[model samples]
Target: MDIEKYIRNIADFPKQGIQFKDITPLLANKDASAQCLENLLQLVGGQKIDKVVGIESRGFFFGTLLAQKLNAGFIPIRKPGKLPYTTLKESYQLEYGMDALEIHEDAIKKGDRVLLHDDVLATGGTASAACSLIEKLGGEIVQCNFLIELKGLNGIQKLKKHIVNSLLQY
Candidate 1:
């Protein structure tokens, strides 16, 4: 549906030389938002997703909705200490700095099939870290899905072992 048109491009955002893709426009439009969700749902039509693990913040929106659409449980991977229960954490390096992410220790049960959902795929650090956390909790990553993918960043290259689907690429 060419969802890119619905995303506003803000130049030099958050810092100089950075172009931010904002989804606020899409969020405000009912048809566009519904179409985006429909497209994402179609991508995993038959996969048995036992749960949908969303990366923190932005991912929460799409993850929770997708989980409901798929009738799967929603699991969230958050910043350290953000989760109220015992957690499993993974730290990784990024171009700017190093950060960590955590998932509840018991978020995933043994042999659970998970479909990880996030708003964007950039550099793949966060997604990769989340994938590790899911595996640590004994979940099989059935697939990873996103609304947008920054292709220039080559984020998918870092996530080599699982299937990845993105509705729009930039």
Candidate 2:
């Protein structure tokens, strides 16, 4: 399924000179979404994933599905103060400034294998911060997965230490 056709490009979304790849079209179509999930699972292969760490709102969409399909726990990495329990935080630099992400302190156990998921890989700041939080909780990052990747941004650079996979690249 040419997933790219299901993705809509919006100009200057959330900022100027930025083209946002919107996945709503893909998400709305059952066939496309299923194909994407299947592809993601293929990328994961048969590796053991103890937990699937999803970054923020968009990540939740496919992250939870991946967790269910893998029979792994679903952990949410959100903005500061978004989590109710004791949380750990990690901050990273964005193109314009900085932002922080937090996860529950007990979200992962020592030696747990984790798969990180997100909607897009732009600057790598958010995903990198999530990785830090997971490592701080003693969760070993198994792989970083994304629905779309802007290769021009070189977001994968910050995630060089771990395996990174994505369904689409632009």
Candidate 3:
């Protein structure tokens, strides 16, 4: 699908020396978007995921579709105070600054196998923090999935203790 071409690169976006990988172009292409979703679903297929935990914002887009494909419940890990129920929160560092994420307290039951999904994995801080929250709530992290991964960032290294997969790498 030449997904790379569809990913727009914004130099020094949100900060200096940071090239942001934008997926808006890919989303505009119907065929590429469908293929990307299918590929993501297949990559994590047969993992026995009970819930798909999608991080805030972009993760929600792919996470919901992946959850539907796997026939598993979609769990959203949103920003703090965004959820309407009792929740658990985790604060972490990003390329810009410190940020927080939240997940419903009753989202995953004990022993539930969960797959965390996001559009891109930059530094592994958000994903790792989400994994910690999921475990604290009794959910087992089966895998973590992403559409694009920036190589040499060592984001995957931080998450090396778990199964992590990405459809594209840059």
Candidate 4:
């Protein structure tokens, strides 16, 4: 599948001077979404992922699917106060602004292998912060994967220490 075609570009979404890569089109198409999920699985290439962590909103879409496909625990890295239980917070910067993500203190067991998923890697702040929370809880990150990565933003620079995979780059 030409997954890139499913990505719709929106000008000045949420704010000006930012081009948003919308995945709603892809999500609406069962075939493309499945193909993208298969591609994500292929990126793992048989790594044993004990847990799959998805970022707050958009990540939840494919994150749940990935967890089901892998038979791994699905964890949500949500915005502050979103999680009901005791949580650890990590603050970070975004391309447009600043935000924080929270993860349950017990989300991952010590030494658990984690796969982090997000819809897009724009500034790396969200992913980097989420990674900190995971490690603070003693979870070893296996990989950080995304549905789309904005290459010009160089989000990978902040995630240089870990394996980062993406199905589509813009």
RMSD of each: 1.2, 0.8, 1.0, 0.7
The candidate with the higher TM-score, 1 or 3, is: 3
TM-score of 2: 0.97
The lDDT of model 1 is 0.89
Predicted structure with the largest TM-score when compared to the true one: 4
lDDT of 1 by residue, 1-170 (tens): 66778999898776677777898898888888889999999989888889999998888987899999989999999999999999898997654468999998989999999999988888899999999999988999999999899999899998999999999899
| Alpha-carbon runs more than 4 Å astray in model 4 | none
Which pairs in model 4 have colliding backbones?
none
Query: How displaced is residue 153 in candidate 2, in Å?
Result: 0.7
Decreasing TM-score order of the candidates: 4, 2, 3, 1
Off-target runs (Cα >4 Å) in candidate 3 are none
Q: Over the stretch 40-144, how does candidate 3's per-residue lDDT look in tens digits?
A: 988886778889999989999889998888889999998888999999988988867899989999999999999999998988889988998999999989999
What TM-score would each prediction reach against the true structure?
Answer: 0.95, 0.97, 0.96, 0.98
List the candidate 2 regions with Cα displacement exceeding 4 Å.
Answer: none
Q: How many residue pairs clash in all the candidates, one count each? A: 0, 0, 0, 0
In terms of TM-score, how similar is model 1 to the real structure?
0.95
Worst 10 residues of 4 by lDDT: 40-49
